[model samples]
Target: MNRIALAVCALALIVAACAGSREEVVEEFLPSLESTTTTAANGDLPSTTTTRPAEDQQIDELIAGLADQVREIRGLPLALPPLEFVPGDQLEERYQALNGLKSIGSTRINEAYLQALGVLPEGDSAADLVSFCSLPGFFDPESATLVLREGLADLTPYGRRLLFDELAGAATNEAHDWWGTMASLERSGNTEAAVGLWALVQGDAAFHAEQYVAESLDSTDQFAIRLEEIACQQESTSPP
Candidate 1:
């Protein structure tokens, strides 16, 4: 399948909690939309309950509005920009658009555009991802996993590493970590994500067991061999 199709499936599966039926699920996922606050040391904007700044409050309201609409879409489709657009390119542009649309917080606009873009197959799914995004929980690993699996390219490498590092720190929680997520994805046989996760495991000592690491290394060797074969075939196809 194409990358867009793959991204759609990833988003569908990982967005479960955000789209679950129970009130508890809604409550659990709601925190992802809350505005974040960082101390002066982190060079972040400050926040307070009663004395929150106007901009922060505005962002909060906007997110709340967006979350309400996304809750209505049960399935969201996947769409890609032009193939000419390279990965990590247009990040600033995309961020600006997302931020602006979010700040506007018009549920109608969110529904119309997200559906038009095929980001939401059903009203319900669109709502879920909106909730996921609006909760502003992408900084958290459990939350970040949802966005990552959804194929969003919002965070920088450093930001992504920080989120995953946090998840790594929570190795004790079976709900978190590569192995746990791998097991979940295994049932679905997400080959690309599995491969990517294995690649991640190969580089990180804390993520996998010796047996898993060894197996991954063997797979890496096999992959290199296969890649060579493909490259050779392409070369043969080209003019002499």
Candidate 2:
């Protein structure tokens, strides 16, 4: 197999392994989901509201900074789209809504073919696995929007890395019209080529994101993120 095919195979196995341990991974890097108590603005009554943590509220400013970094790293002028943060419960809904524009039957056929080749586990749809293993945010090329999962304001190393990745994706889209290219490839019935292109695009974003992390984050954060990546790789290679 070529490099892209090898990368896709590796990613498929890693995602399969990760499906069983997602909660553990999340708990290790993300804060607990307990609601915070806040006092009323008037200072007379203490109303219990599940407000976003103060630290998490800086997500917008952080994303703005990330966009600038992406531009610098990619050396491309980027027009960032409007950003939206959706609750965890709505993640799949949003994903499916965006996915609706694509050919679901084609996805299913591809999933089955991969499973037949042992690239993907039986009984696991590509769509489901992708949704499960994807980062907490994505850039919607069709809508020209950056959508993130709420509560990323804590700015954990993992969260920061995700921001960089998504920003890079946005930059890539701006420069190359990612969705349009993929759509054209699909329309031409070049399924294998389309898959290869998808992998290339994602890999490019990931490479730039890592560069951003190395250039911008503190040593401690960089080390923590690297350790997390190593752990996930180890898990993927471990025996079942």
Candidate 3:
């Protein structure tokens, strides 16, 4: 499916949360939309419009508002990159595709070295550890794009907070050249310094995100968002 279709599907799924059952949710969400397809000028992926034009515009506005809030809270000037939404199920595929472009041998060597140093567990590769430990959404510094997990359709409280987290991250990157610094540290094999820097960067973003929540959202929404975040964290770390 094309990107627009995937976005519509993602949004639809989010709306479907109030509805019952997975199969029913998909059926309810897809049947209401109209779709049209056209090939891109570059002859790459075909572009499709699967939802109302206003839906896309709303998403753009939502991002802009969140970005402004992030800048306000973090006190950083931000030039936000283009935004892309991928279906939640395609997250792993998208991650692997991006990860594949890196130097595999160097990455493996680093993973082995880190594991030997007890930075990573014996069986865990760097890629696997990152995929598991990091948040679902990320700002890709190389591509200068903010890629978010799709299900942000209705701008539910949780969805809004999650989007804010990514915006905060993007702002942090803009201010600090986060990825470039991390890459330099990695190349120099300064593992301890790299880890410390990574922690500080993430903590900065998290702090701003929390500030946004506390300052902007209503008390009810603030509580709900925090509860959902904690639940998600527990779910991610839980044993299958």
Number of the top TM-score candidate: 2
Q: Tens-digit lDDT track for model 3 on 135-232? A: 44556667677666665445656667666776666666665566676567668865434433444444456556667878999999988876765665
Estimate every model's Cα lDDT from 0 to 1.
0.30, 0.55, 0.52
**Each prediction's Cα RMSD?**
22.3, 14.2, 17.3
Model 3 CA RMSD to the hidden true structure, in angstroms: 17.3
Local accuracy of candidate 1 as per-residue lDDT tens digits, 60-106: 33323222222221111111111111123233233323322333222
Where in model 3 is the C-alpha error above 4 Å?
Answer: 1-55, 93-136, 237-240
Residue pairs clashing in model 3 are none
Cα lDDT tens digits, model 2, 37-110, are 22112111111124545544366666666666766776655666676677776755666555431345342126
The number of clashing residue pairs in each candidate reads: 17, 1, 0
TM-score: model 2 vs. ground truth: 0.64
Off by over 4 Å in 2: 1-57, 96-109, 127-134, 227-240
Candidate 3 lands at a TM-score of 0.60
